[model samples]
Target: MRVFVAGATGVIGSRLVPLLLSTGHDVIGLARSQDAGAGLERLGADVVHADALDHAAMRHAVRVAAPDAVVHLLTAIPARIDPRRLSRDFAQTNRLRTQGTINLVDAAAQTGAKRVITLGSASVYEPNGPDPATEDVPFWHRPPKEFIPVLDALRELEALTAEAGGLVLRVGHLYGPGTIYARNGSFLHQVQSRNVPIVGQGTGTFSFTHIDDAARAIVAALETTADGALNVVDDEPAQVGEWLPVLADLLDVPPPVHIPVQMARSAFGSWGVAFMTELRGADNTNAKRVLDWSPKYPSWRQGFEAELAHPGSP
Candidate 1:
């Protein structure tokens, strides 16, 4: 299969290009800069220099590539985030999820692409649920204001993808080399700096995925005819209190400090507190059954160790 990947130089796309090439797929990647284009060429992907936000250019590129499948991995998240500026920080990424997805999907459709796969976040699910969220669960009816754009963009992206018979992989909190959860990454720094504190009961559960596992799921999606949404998370869904100390241990850092719920809200805003105290985990059972995909790092516990062992891992 010939595949065109937007965000080809991104965290997941960088890993995915080599994997796709190894699997006998001809890959074409969108590159916005000369360096990115050169890097993709080095990795054996034919490079198309275009930004995902440029609809006309993307359509032209896709038409030129004439790929059998299109993959969207575009996002603009920074390596580090200040909790107080969550909404400001996510504005560009929100646009990428909503507008960038629209452009890519449209481009793919225009080019007669048969299949499309795009990334989605599991964090859009509602909070404090007893059961982990399956793909069928509804998004939060009233998400915090700061997260409204993020959720709205995801909804739009998913709707567009589903209408086009594309696959939307609702991935979990990603942790691995080049991800925020890496030893040298933002989350680790936050932990080391004591900015990521355990709040209240610290009961909000999160599903996690290693970068390699997430990329593998993308590879699996390419072959499967499964359309619409699938949750691509690991086996375990753990609470903040459960994972934080373990993460601290893996990084050889002190356990995260505890804060009262009110203090957390004041410090990190309501969204941050909600994420720590109420967000639900994702269930990946359907992905495993339908895509025949299983996570290489089935749990963050083992994933963390592997991440730390890798030299200069993100």
Candidate 2:
């Protein structure tokens, strides 16, 4: 199979290219810079230089690749995000999710691609309520704030891909070498700096995924052509209390200071609080059953250790 990976320079894209190549697929990647193309070339992927937001360029690149499958990993995160403004801010990423997904899906159709697979987030689910949420759970029940626009874009992208052949994977809070999940720099960055405080008794249990697992599950869907939403996650679904001290321990930092849930809500708003302390974990039975995919790292602790060592796995 010939595969074209958009956003080939991203955290997942860098790892995904080699995985597709190892499987005997002729891989082509979208790169916007000479440096980005150089990296993809080193990984044995044919480079297609174009901006994903540029529909015409993206369409042309896809047509040129003439791929059997198209994987969408494009995001504006690298260009805009910094340590100062982290995941707490997501409006630009939201635009990339909604509008960028629409454009990429359209480009896939124009290129006559057979399958389309997108990287989605477990954050799409409501923060409170039942643990271990499934793909069939309703999405619009929550207020239209944090996860709605992104999931709405995902729904639109899925609808468009279904017209061809499509799979949308809702991945958990991402962790890996190059991602926000690894290193004390991300969530731990806040914790270490004492910028983060425990809210609501630290009761919310959230889903998380290793970066390699995320890249692999997405490509697995592309290879197998299994359609619909598959929750990509690790074996462990953790509560805030359970993971916080563990993470702080890993970084050799102090435990997060606790704050009242209402105070936290008033300070960060519902979306921000839910993201930091939420209880939505996604079930991965469908992905394991259909795509023959299982996470190499059973939990974030094991995954994070390996990730901090590798620096190249992301």
Among all windows of 10 consecutive residues in model 1, the one with the lowest summed lDDT is 305-314
Report residue 303 deviation for candidate 2 (angstroms): 1.3
Candidate 1 per-residue lDDT, tens place, 1-314, comes to: 99999888888888899999999999999988999899999888899888788788888889999999999999999898765677888889888888788888898888899999999988778776779998888999997788887788889989989988999999999886678887678888888887788999799899998878888999999999999899999899999999999988876778888889998888888888888888899988999999999999888777777777565543
Give candidate 1 misplaced runs (Cα > 4 Å): 309-314
Model 2 over residues 140-248: C-alpha lDDT tens digits?
Answer: 4664355555556666666765665688888887776566555634655666777767777777677788767887887678657588778899878888877877777
Q: Candidate 2: lDDT of 310?
A: 56
Backbone Cα, N, C clashes tallied per candidate: 0, 0
RMSD, candidate 2, Å? 2.9
TM-score for each candidate, following the candidate numbering: 0.97, 0.89
> Which residue pairs show backbone clashes in model 1?
none
lDDT (0 to 1) per candidate: 0.87, 0.73
* Global CA lDDT computed for model 2: 0.73
